[model samples]
Target: MAITPNYYETLYITRPDIQEEDLAKIQQKLQDSISSNEGEIIKADKWAERNLAYEIQDHKKGTYYILVFKALPNASKEVEKHLQFYRTDILRFITLKTTEEAVNKNKASEEKKEKTEPTTPTPPPAAPPTTTAAPTPPPAAPEPPTAAPEPPPAAPEPPTAAPEPAATPPTEAPASTEEAKTENTDTQEEGGTN
Candidate 1:
């Protein structure tokens, strides 16, 4: 009494040198025809303009058009009828049903797993509170005793160290203000893309 939508996809080949205007019309026509027959065109793909494995109708090159649509079983027959009119222009086409329902069923079954299996694992990380006792830390080592206080030592003067080497700035200073900021940023950061 009711028609269930099915995932259907088909691919066809067209003339390699078809004009850009003609190409859009050709693609839209397929979509329009599908919609007219109680079908919805999900997506269309222009795979590539490729040379045929073997010559078909004396044409060695063809443009591949792939269409993915959804509709009832009878609507697919009408799609085939549209493809039948042109044997030369369109070299070949094939329609196949996508098993989406089976795929969704598999997804649902995976979701149902946690319900059937135990919510909590057999051995939980920690059981309900059974008087959680705090762990005691290890004893600290004893400090060494003070040595005898000797005579007061003389204060040493601060020793002078050699002067640090002066840094030489980059040779590649960018000419523009914008470029200078960018180059300075590049120098500051280790990541120099150029």
Candidate 2:
């Protein structure tokens, strides 16, 4: 036979009326037995009294207890044997490998996260953005109008000279004798005015 290295947990139910004092005594005895057998009692959790699925020994409700312990493989058989001998209990049990220290199980590991002050002091709240500096949010951006407005480039140069400044001066004058004479004179002198 070879010894093994691992742990197992067991849960069983006992009659509900078996008062807390007796329950504690029974648990202590079991703990002692396990230690005496060269095993360590990792943890024991007692659940609130509750009803069972079926009556075992005519008791409708029972106490649910979970025991986590580490020991050789034979330790499981020892626990089962003790549970069977104690007929006062409904005596249902299970055993499995433990993944962590039972004491920390289900307990929040982050208790305020070991709070530390920030390396840099907190900055003051920001004031409402000023209209002059902070650009306006441009109203919910209308559905990108079918036509987008484009701004001309910032750089400006001298306006180019007109190509045909005199191309349409004839028709601009009213058709009157005085106007006719003025137009002929204006064209003959190349835009010389009286």
Candidate 3:
């Protein structure tokens, strides 16, 4: 049987506090693991640090990194296991398979953008109209109304107090009272005997 290589992209976030040296070390370790499994690294890049949508391991923000590689089927399992074991360094990670169709589509769109971008400059503001028209006096401001208009009636004031708390059920209150009475009688009997 012929073995087929799979292309995968993994995005992971590292704790924001990790030092530069340690970050580099972690990257090297991942690269080594991939190579040892006969995988080829196509790209490894770090994106800008950003705030996470939710906290992970008490970290509010993390540095994002993406690794694109080609590997055998089982290589992904090993990579995930490694990241899981290093919980302190990695906050979160996800790996996804890249399909040939998607990659081709992306390349086509990028080429189209590049080809069209330079040819269009913001069409210079429509050349000023070639002919000028006689300037008309700005329409005279509407004559002020003869008398000041009456002010609108004041709006009703909102109620000052908050809505009353929901009423408790009658049955619940009686049950609690009965329990309290029983406890009080027991305490009274104990005091008298002593």
Candidate of highest lDDT = 3
Estimate the TM-score for candidate 3: 0.55
Query: Candidate 3: lDDT over CA atoms?
Result: 0.68
lDDT of every predicted structure (CA atoms): 0.62, 0.61, 0.68
Instruction: Flag the better candidate by lDDT, 2 or 3.
Output: 3
Report the C-alpha lDDT of model 2 over 1-194, residue by residue, as the tens digit.
66664677788888877767876767777777677667898668785588878887788888888888877666777777777777676446666666555435533342333332352234322344464446656665754542222211111111232323323333322233234444455565675452
Clash pairs of candidate 1?
none
Ten-residue stretch with the least lDDT total in model 3: 148-157
**Alpha-carbon runs more than 4 Å astray in model 1:** 101-194
TM for every model, in the order presented, reads 0.47, 0.47, 0.55
Task: Give the best candidate by TM-score.
Answer: 3
User: How accurate locally is residue 42 in candidate 1, as Cα lDDT from 0 to 100?
Assistant: 66
TM-score-superior candidate, 2 or 3: 3
Q: Write the per-residue lDDT of candidate 3 for residues 1-194, one digit (tens) a residue.
A: 97777888888999998888877877777787778778888778886699999999899999999887788767777778777877788999998999767655755886898888876665434434422332333344433331222111111112221222111223343344344444555666688798
Cα lDDT tens digits for candidate 1, 88-173 = 46778898888777545645885798576786585455654432432222232222211211111111111121111111222222
